[model samples]
Target: MKKYFTQLSYLLDSQAKKTIPLLILSFLFSSVLDVIGVGLIGVFLGLLTNPHFFLQKFPDLAFLLQGLSEKKIIGLFGVLIIVAFAVKAILTLLIQAKVIFFCQLLLVRLKNRMMIAYQYAPYTYHLQRNSSYLISRIQDNIGSFIGNVFLPLLNLISSGFIAISILSLLAILHPFITLFLVSMFFSVGLVFDLFVKQKLSSMGKIVSLSNGEMIKTIHHSLHGLTEIRVLGREDYFLQWLSKISHRYAHAAGILVALQQIPRYLIENMIAIFIIGLTLGGIAAGFSISGVVAMVGMFAAAGARLLPTVTQIMSAINQIRGYLYQTQLVYEELVELESITKGSKKIKSLYQKFDKLTFSTIFLSNVNYQYPHTDYSALKNVNITLHKGQSIGLVGPSGAGKSTLVNVILGFLEPESGQLLIDGKPIDNLREWLNNFAYIPQIIFLLDDTLRRNIALGIDDHEIDEDRITKVIQMAQLTEVVQQLPEGVDTLLGENGVRLSGGQRQRVALARAFYHERDVIIMDEATSSLDHETEQEVINTIKTLKGNKTLIVIAHRLSTVENCDILLRLEKGRITKVGSFADVVGISS
Candidate 1:
C-alpha cells in the first residue's frame, strides 16, 4: 500500500494541494448537514411514539411550548422536520456541484502536467519508451485513474465523515445496542475486505498490463497497415489483437463486478441485523409503541450507515483496482520532470538562431553508447563542420552515421566529448537546433493544404506566400502544385497519400527550404525520386553551394559527388574526411 501510494502522494502534493482547504470545508459541511437532517427525523419519531414521554425528557422546551397542546406541538414538529430535510437536500446538491467541478478541474490539470512533462522530456527518454505506452498514459490511463482512484479517494474521505456522524447519533440513543451493531458490522467489513483485497489488486494488475498490450498491438497494426497488407501478415496481427482484447475485456469486467459485490452483500446483511434487533425487542416484553420508536431510529440510522459503509468499501475496491495505472501516471510525470530538469531556458525549438554567430561546429573525442547496451554506437568521432560547407555522409548499415548525426543534432549527448559552437561549448540544445532544418527519409505530412505543408506551424493567413512560392520553384514542387485542382490550396490526403513518392520528397524539400534556416540536413532525401527528379534535387542542392550549409546522408555516391567534402564512415569510425575525390577513389 505504501509503495503504490508513494507516487500518488507525490502527485497530489505537486498538483492538487490547492484544493485541500475548500475540499475539507465541503466534506465538513456535508457531514454536519447529514447529522442535523437525521437528528430532526429522530425528534419526529420521538413525538410520534409518546409525545409527553419525549417532552418530559426535554423539559427545557416547556417555555417554548407553554400554550400549545400535544397534538399541535407534534404537528409543528412534523413540519419543521420536513423543512430540515428539505434544506439538507438543497445544500447536498450545492456541495455535490462544487465537488464535481473540483474533481474535473483537478483531472484537467493533471493531464496538462503530463503533457508538459512529455513535451519537455529529453529525446533520449522518448527513444527508450514505447509510443503506445506513453499515449495510453496521456489518453486512457489518466481518465481511469481519475474515475477509479482519485474520485474514489475523495469519496472514501467524505464517506468516513458521514459514517462517523451516523455512528455518533446511534451512540447517543442506546449505547449498548450501538456498541453491538458497530462491532458486528466492523468485523464483517474488515473480514470481507481482507478476503477480497488481494484478488482485486491482482485483477487490477492484469487489467492495467493487458490494456497497455492491447493498445500497443492496435497502434502497431494501424500504424503499419500498409506493411501488414502488402506482406499479407494481417491475420497474424489480428489474432494477437483478439487474444489481448479478450484478456483485457475479461479482467476489466471482473474488476467492475468485484467493486459492486460488496455493496449488495452489505445491504442484505444490514437488513438481517435490523430484523434480529426487532425480534430481540419483542422477546424483552417492551410495549409495541416504545419498541417501534426505538426500532424506527435504528432503521433510519442503519439505512444511512449501511449505504455509507458500502460506498466506502466500494470506493476502496475501485482504488485498489486502479492502483497500478495511478502509480504509472504519477511515476511518468515525476520521471519526466527529473530527466528534463533545468531545461526551462532551452524551451522553443523554433527560436531565432540568426543572432548567434557561429563559424564552425567542432566535435572532439566524442563517444556514445545507447542505454542498456555495452557496444559503442559512435567511437572517437572527431569532426568539424564549417560555414558554407556541403558534407556528405556515406556508410553501410550499422555504420553509426545516424548516431553521429544525432549527437551533432543534440538528440543524443556524447558520453565524453566537447561540441563547441565557434569556440564555446554548446549548452542550449534547442537554441543550437534552430540553426538547421531536417528533412527525413520518410516525411510525415498532415492531411492539410499544400500551402500549410510547405509553411508548417504558421497559420494559413500568416504564411509567407512569396517564400512558399519561392521554395516550391526551388524544390521543383511548383509543377506538381500547378497541376493540382486548387494548386497550393489542395489538401494532401493522410500522410500525403495523394502525392506520389517523388512529389512527396519534393514537398518535403519545399518545406525545408521554406524554413529559411542556416543549415539543412537531408536524410536520404532523394531516395524516393526518379533519375530525373533526383537530378532536379541535386541541382536544387547546388543552388545552396555558396548560400547555406548542407549535410546529406545517402548510399548513392553519385548524388554527393559534387559535395565540397565527403565523410566515409566504416563501422563506427570515420576513415576518410576531405574533398570528394580524396574520400572516394574516383573524381566527380
Candidate 2:
C-alpha cells in the first residue's frame, strides 16, 4: 500500500496533490452526514414504536412535544427524516461526481505527461524497449492503473469512512450487538482476503503479462502482414493469438469471480446473523419497544454497512489484482522522467547560433556497444565528413553500417572517444543533430494527407506550401501527387499503404528535402525505385553534390559510382576509405 501510494505521489502534480486533501475532507464530511442520517432514522423508529419512550429518553424535548399528539409528532419526524436523507443524498452525489471528474482530469494529464517524457527521453531508452510494450504501457497499462487501481483505492478509503461512521452509530445504540457484528464480519473478511490474496495477485500478473503478449502478437502480425502472406503463415499467427487471448480471458474472468464471490457469501451470513439477533432479543424478554427499536437501528445500519464492507473488500482485492499494472506504469514514468530531465540538462547547454557555422564533423576512435551486450557495434571508428561532400558507405551484412549511422545521428552515444564539430567536441547533441536530416531504409508515413506527410510534424497553418511544392518536384513526387484524387492533399493511409514502395521512398525523399538540413543521410533511399526513378533520384543527389553534405549507405556498387568518397566497412571497422577507384579497384 505504501509502495502504491508512493507511485501515485510520483505521478500527481502539485495541484492534484492539493486536491486530494479536499477530497478526503469532503469524504469525512459525507461520513458525518451519513451518521446523522442513520441516527435520525433510529429516532423515527423509536417514535413510531412508542412516542412516550422518545419523550422519556429526552426530557428536555418533552416540553416541545407537550402540545402535540403522537401521530403529529411521528409525521413531523418522518418528514424531517426524509428531508435529511434527501439532503445527504444530494451532497453525496455532488462529492462523487467531483471525484469522478478529478479522476478523468488526472487521466488526461497523466497521458500527456507520459507522452512528453517519451518525446524527450534518450534515444537509447527507446532502443532498449519494444514498441508494443511501450505502446501497451501508455495505452493499456496506464488506463488500468487509473481505473482499476487508483480509482478503486479511493473508493476503498471512502467506503472505510462510511463503514466507520455507521458502525459508530450502531455501537452507541447497542454496544454488545454492534461489537458482535463488527467482530464477525471483520473476521470473515480478513480470513477470506488472506486466503485468496496470493491467488488474486498471481492472476493479476497473468492478466498483465498476457495483455502485453497479445498486443505484441497483434502488432507484429499486422505490421508484418505482407511477409506473413508471402510465407503463408496466417494460421501460425492466428494460433499464437488465440493461445494468448485465452490466457488473458481466463485470468481476467477469474479476477472478476473472486471479487464477486465474497459478496453473496457475506450477505447470506449477515442475514442469518440479523435473524438470530432478533430471535435472541425476544427470548431475553426485552421490552417490546426496546426490542423493536434495537432491531430497527440494526437493520438501518446493516443496510448501509453491508454494501460499504463489500465495496471495501472488493476494492482491496481489485487493488491487489491490478497491482502489477500500477508498478509497471510507475516504473516506466519514473525512468522516462529521469532520462527526460537528464536530456533537458543536455539540451540546456544548447547554444543557438543563427545557423550551423561548422563546415565539418569529425569522429575520432569512437566505440559503441549496445546494453547487455559484450561486443561493440562500432569499434575504433574514425571518420571525417566535410560540408558539401558526398560520402558513400558500402558494406556486407552485419558490418555495423547502420550502427555507425546511428552514432552519427546522435541516436547512440559512443562508449569512448569524441565526435567533434569544426575541431571542437559537440557540447549539445540537439544542436549537432539540427544540422542533419536522415532518410531511413524503412519508410514510416503518417495516416495523413500527402502534403502533411512531407511537411511532417509541422501544423497545417504553419506549413510552407511553396516549399512543399518545390521539394515534391525535387524528390520526383510531383507526378505521384498529381495522380492522386486530392493531389498533395490526398491521404496516404498508415505507413503509406496506399502508395507503392517506390512512391513511399519518394515521399521520404521529399520529407528530407522539405527539412533542408545542412547534411542529408540516406540509407538505401532509392533501393525500392526502378532504374529510371533511381537514376532520377541520383541525378537529384548530384545536383546537391557541392551544396549539401550527403552520406549514402547502399548495397549496390553502382549507386556509389559518382560519389566523391567511398568507404568500405567490415565487422564494425572501416576497411577502406578513398575514391571509388581506390575502394572498389575500378574507375567510375
Quick one: best TM-score, which candidate? Answer: 2
TM-score of each: 0.93, 0.95
Candidate 1: segments with Cα more than 4 A from true spot? 1-5, 13-15, 69-71, 342-355, 459-467, 525-533
Instruction: Please write out the lDDT profile of model 2 over residues 489-513, one tens digit for every residue.
Output: 8999988889976688788878888
Q: Spell out the clash pairs found in candidate 2.
A: none
Question: How good is model 2 by TM-score?
Answer: 0.95
How well does candidate 2 score on lDDT at residue 399?
84
Q: Number of backbone collisions per candidate, in order?
A: 0, 0
| Candidate achieving the largest lDDT | 2
Q: Tell me the deviation in Å of residue 433 in model 2.
A: 2.0
Q: Please, what is the whole-model Cα lDDT of each candidate in the order they appear?
A: 0.81, 0.84
Error of 2 at 302 (Å): 0.4
